[model samples]
Target chain A: MFVAWRDLRTAKGRFALMGTVIVLVTLLVGLLSGLTAGLARENVSGVTGLPADRLVFAEPPDGRSPSFSDSAVSEGQWRSWARRPGVVDAAPLGVRTTEAAAAPGSGGGTGGGAARVAVAAFGAEPGGRLAPGGLAPGRVVLSARAAEELGVRVGDRVRLGPGTAAVAAVEGDASHAHLPVVWTALQDWRRLPGAPGGATVIALTTGEGFTAAASEAADEALGTTALTVDEALAAIGSYQAENGSLQLMRGFLFAISALVVGAFFTVWTVQRAPEIAVLKALGASTGYLLRDALGQALLVLTAGTLAGTALAAGAGLLIGRSEVPFAVEPATVLVPAAVTVVLGAAGAALSVRRITAVDPLTALGSAR
Target chain B: MTLLLDDVTLTYEDGGGRLTALDRVRLDVPAGTVAAVVGPSGSGKSSLLAVAATLIAPDRGRVVVDGADTAALDRGARSRLRRERVGIVFQQPNLLPSLTAAEQVQLMAHLSGRPPAAARDRARELLAAVGLAGEADRRPHRLSGGQRQRVNIARALMNDPAVLLVDEPTSALDHERGAAVLDLLVGLTRERGTATVLVTHDREHLARADRVLTMRDGRLTGA
Candidate 1:
């Protein structure tokens, strides 16, 4: 890398400009990745955080996908599933998004004032197999975010529809469809406004021996179709569309980053063609030249990417605390940086491949 | 101690046909002597230097430099031959813009897989031999044309090559500077015992060489 290192030092301004571009692109990718993960959490953490290994949703009609909003499981379905061999437990679970009112004296609330917070309430029988920590009647378990937004803590009386209730506990942060979650008794959940008076779906704890035949028999007896948990993600219409579009945009950004890096190195290699020819005439092998150029590129890429990753992490730390909906984790930060480095290196390698084509005879003339 | 081009022939593609650059050319230079090749433009003087330097493989003959048969060597072996036994002085001096006078000389050793820093003593000695001892730290852009050319000569000898092929080393300089460069080339050829081939269009520098050959239309005579 003797010539390469010298070239970088001699043309500091050009290399610096290119480095800055790499840094900015890396920053954009890192931030986008963080925000994507954060937004996804807001849309699915509630379902993902469930204690059940798998969520069973009623199959949609006419070949449509299962959805929590449209799915309704009957009590007969739950009974049939509970009685089946290899089915250790089965519980009817209802999900509903509603405006929650907090009692006065909760933090930041005036006397007799009501603070309404959006929540997706999950209902289950007290001590039932699918109950998360065994929720009971007249009491609700509020997710951390829901408790914070409603300014209510454990033992506080919160109103749901017309009835008043006490907060059982404040647990992990979980959301569904951008709304925080609340756990309540199944009977109390059915009394709430807009309640369909039936379970939204069934949560089953199936043993290893559970078979499709048994599921089919239960479905037939209960007159309901079933689907696995991962297959149920399509049920949230807004989540599917939003997540897909964001992911596509991220993919485009990655592609654009690679192309931009490739183009820069292409022009850079052309500019250094004369130098390469001179080196070749001086008995430097093509392999030596290629390694030198690639080493120079890696130096620039690593520095730029590290700076960009740090900036993204700092920015995410700040934005995550606010309402920007960004997750700051290793997957969100390091994964993007790693991808940028690999793709950028590949682009640089493509551009520098032209070095092999340089003719040393060009270095023989009176005008190099 | 040996540089020989035996009945070499080289051709290039020209307008969908072939153009002969060197036709049945033969030359041999012994160690400790400077053999100058004087020729008209387009007469394959440069082509002969290139062939002798192992930069071009002839269509039908062998270039043996310091006992290495270049005709049978692959690209890597040819490159190694050039790095180890052959030194070429380009016509334009062709100093890398990023390297200083000393670094230009040191680069030859670097290309030969030796530590550049380990060759510093020799680089400084070569620079002093070329009378650029006071300008060792100057970059190509900072040095005058003649000084840059001297650095070029010093760089070629950095690896102690057995054969040196110099291509019009003084073409870009004035008469006084050109004569000085020729004098230095002659002195180095004798002192280093290298088989030197100097290509030039000017006859004024021929007095410094032990022998002179003239070329026209890709053929050689008047040794």
Candidate 2:
């Protein structure tokens, strides 16, 4: 990379311009990745945090996908799954979005005043693994955010629809459809107005004998749709649409980065065509020239990506301290940086391949 | 003979037909001597130099450089041959703008897989030999036209190639600078014992060569 190194040093302004573009693009991609992951966590953390391996939903009508808002599984379905071969356990789970407020005349009221907040009510059996803490008839488990919003801790009374329950425990920062979760007893959940008769879905755990075919056969016979814990996240309508849009934006950013890098190197290679022919005539092999060019590109990409990732992580750290959800982990930071480098290198490689076609004879008598 | 072109013929696809660039051209240059070829603009002098440098393969006949037959070699082998045995001085100095004069000369050694320490020393020695000792660290934009051409000559000789093909080295210089460059070329040819082929349009500098040849219409006559 003797010539390549010198070229970069000699053409500082040009390369700096290109490098700045990469850094900005990488920064955008990194922040978007963090935001996407953060939003997804808020949308489905309640479902994803369940201890069950799979979820069984009441099958929708023809041509409709299963949805958390639309699915309603009865006690018969949960009992059938619990007794099926290879099934270790099955528990009924209900999900509903509603308002929760501090009960009046209770010591847990915020500043001795009433406070109301939106919450996702999850119903489960008293001792089921699907509940974070044990549920009881007159007590509820409030997620960290729900407890904070309602100003109610353990032993504090909170009013649900038509009833009031003490906060049995406050644990985890789980949410569903962007609302904090509040775990209640199945009996208490059904007492709410317009609540489902039985449960929203059935959480299940299967042993080794539960093959894919068996699961399919069981789904057909029981009139339900079975999905793995991860796959069931799509059942949240808001999560599907929001996550899809963010992912599409991220995809477009990647494509734009590749195109921008490709365009920069295309013009650079064209400007150096005469020099390339001269090098070829001087007996520089095609492989040597290619390696030199690619090495230069990698150096630029690595530097720019590192800088961009560092900046994004710094920004995410500051943003995370506020109300906005922004994650600053390796998956959010390093993965985007790596993708940027690899894609930028690929773009550069395609552009520099034109070096192979430059005719060495042109360097003989042609004017520079 | 260190460089021998045995009845080489080359043609190019011109429009719908073939244009004969070199027709049955033969030339020989022994070691420690210079042969000058003078020609009109399109008389194929550059073609002969290119053929001798292994930059272009002839349609018929063989190109022998330092006892190796280039026609029998593949593209990679030909490139290796050029790196090890042939050196070409282009019509324009064509110094890379990013490289220093010393780096320009050192690049030849790098291409041949030489050690950096040795290549650097050799490059300095060649630059001094071409009388650019103090100008080694300067880039092409900082040097004069004649100085740049001298760096070009030093670069071509850095590999100590057995065959040196020079193309209009003095085209961009005036009479005094051109004559001085020609004198330097002749002296270096004899001093390094390289078989040199110098192609030029000017007849005034032919006296410095051991032999002079003339080309017209793809044929050579005077020697």
Q: How do the candidates score on chain B by TM-score?
A: 0.97, 0.98
Task: Please write out the lDDT profile of model 2 over residues A182-252, one tens digit for every residue.
Answer: 99998999888778999999999999788888888889999999999999999999999999999999999
- What is candidate 1's lDDT per residue for B28-79, written digit by digit as tens? 8999999989978889998888888788888998888998888789999898
**lDDT (CA) for every model shown?**
0.85, 0.90
Question: Could you tell me the lDDT of residue B108 within candidate 2?
Answer: 92
What's the true lDDT of residue B96 in model 1?
A: 87
Q: lDDT tens string, model 2, B71-111? A: 78988898899988888888899899999999999999888
Where is model 1 more than 4 Å wrong at Cα?
A79-89, A103-113, A205-231, A366-368
- Relative to the real complex, the DockQ score for model 1 comes to 0.55
When candidate 2 is compared with the true two-chain complex, its DockQ is: 0.60
Give me the overall lDDT of model 1. 0.85
DockQ values of all predictions: 0.55, 0.60
Q: Which stretches of candidate 2 lie over 4 Å from their true place?
A: A107-113, A366-368
Superposition error at B72 for model 1 (Å)? 1.4
Error of 1 at A102 (Å): 1.6
Highest DockQ against the true fold, candidate: 2
